[model samples]
Target: MAELPKSVSIREVGPRDGLQNEDPIPTEAKVRLLDALSRTGVRRIEAVSFVHPRAIPQMADADEVWQRAAKVDGVRYSALVPNSKGAQRALAAGFTEIEVVVSASDTHNRRNVNRGTDESLDDIAELIDLLHQAGATAEVIIATSFGCPYEGDVDPARVAAIVDRAVRDGADRVAFGDTTGMGTPRRVRGLITAVRDRDADIPVLLHFHNTRGTALANLLTALELGVTEFDASVGGLGGCPYAPGASGNLATEEAVHMLHDMGIDTDIDLDALIEVAELAEELTGRRLPSGVLRAGPRTRLTASSG
Candidate 1:
């Protein structure tokens, strides 16, 4: 068995990645959700994304939402930017931490940004430089890192090469996204090893989806490999726009519960997180796919009569 990490950092992406696929809710509702999540003791939150209104209509109010959200002290808030234009918008909105995405699969990349994988990488390089020059941090998220719905079983080498290029282009950090939730333990280990071999110093974050019930398992594998950062959603509220019927992200409550029980420190209040998850479900008007939300945490016990 591999040695478990003493603690981990969970970046809550529900406000951005989780809500980007859902129906457009009122701006006030978005602010409410963000405020509720801020009080959950989660140190990092991906607040919003600055994308074209036509591309992701759900996030059309990114500007207003960010401007209205009650900024919390001691909490680091970030947003996603699709290109140079989105990066500029995020910077103008006074965001210092920004994320940009590129897909490992060519087909997925073309479908996501209407550009080939190489072209998207070139764009990412330029975006990273622009963000750095603006005194901002840039994080590159490689979508479809595990497997692509359109193209099954992505090669690990391709993913590592992308990581190499992103680091060379001055990315502050990089995250691997299991976009379609096709990650397994073996694949996760191989991909991490490949990336580590290329640049062990690069900060890595894993984003998993529970589509096939392997998100937690893959997370465990990455944990054993000394990966201490992850991206999860509150109430499991995200899915790929192009992949039909795929599940949302790994639930924050579920991850917190498991980590707490295993003696891993996440510095998150489980009950508070559950409450936020409930609020997310209520706001979306949909039943979220959260195991903890349905079945309470493992620590909950009932007294029995003799």
Candidate 2:
């Protein structure tokens, strides 16, 4: 292993992405979980989503969650918005950072948003313009940047093109999602290099699903590519409904532990992150997919070596 980089940013998405996949947990419980995550030293948190309740019933109470969770100082809280209406509600709720997702795979795009690739791009551009007019930061989440389950193999060229379109639309940043957890280390490295080769100076983030047990390996590939921003769930509690057999998002505790072990300064307190991971499990009444959350980290011991 080499010397690790310091000062990486971990964006906590447990409240929005983590909970949206599960059966409805009360909004109060969601707020409490977000509140707990705020103190764990995460610089940013996706506290809520402003989508229609009909689309995602779990996130129907976005207003209440934002109202309660926004009070935490020193943390930049964001909301996921699907369109102009979603952006409108998010701004009205006093959120400054908003994220909109568009799929790179055409099949997944039509399935998720009922629109073709170009149509969704146009919609996202409009939402970006809306966010800009309202003095908010707009980010693009290019879901299924890896291989899509519905459409077997996703071309790196397609992923690069989607990123280019988003960058042209005035997005502040772009995060590529491994929605199905089907990405390998080679794919991760290749796609990242492809994006950079076409569009340099774009701040890119990685969102991973631990399905097929390759999420951590993909993270390592991104780290080698100098990607410091990542989206993670506290206890690895969210999976893609569109991708069958997909696991939850990469675990926050596992990422923190990996970073700390590599001497990377994530600004996250490991014990505090673990505590929040437990809360996520308790709140959802489901098991988290994080290894560190269960077996614990391999840390330096007080026992003397013989």
lDDT of the candidates, in the order given: 0.92, 0.87
Task: Give stretches of model 1 more than 4 Å off.
Answer: 240-246, 303-306
Ten contiguous residues minimizing lDDT sum, candidate 1: 239-248
**What TM-score would candidate 1 get against the native?**
0.97
Output the number of the TM-score-best candidate: 1
Residue by residue across 1-306, what tens digits does model 2's lDDT show? 534457589999988998998779998898889889999989999988988999899999889877776466789999999888888999999888999998889998999889998899999998999899999999999988988888887999999998889999999999999888878999998899999999998899899888888888888888888888999998887866756445678898898898888778888889988988888889888877789888777873556887
lDDT of 2: 0.87
> Which ten residues in a row are the worst by lDDT in model 2?
239-248
- Residue 31's lDDT within candidate 2 is 82
lDDT string for model 1 (184-273, tens) is 999999999999999899999999999889988998999999999999999999865556566779999989988898899988899999
Position 248, candidate 2: lDDT: 70
Residue 275 shift from truth in candidate 1, angstroms: 0.2
Candidate 2 vs. true structure, TM-score? 0.95
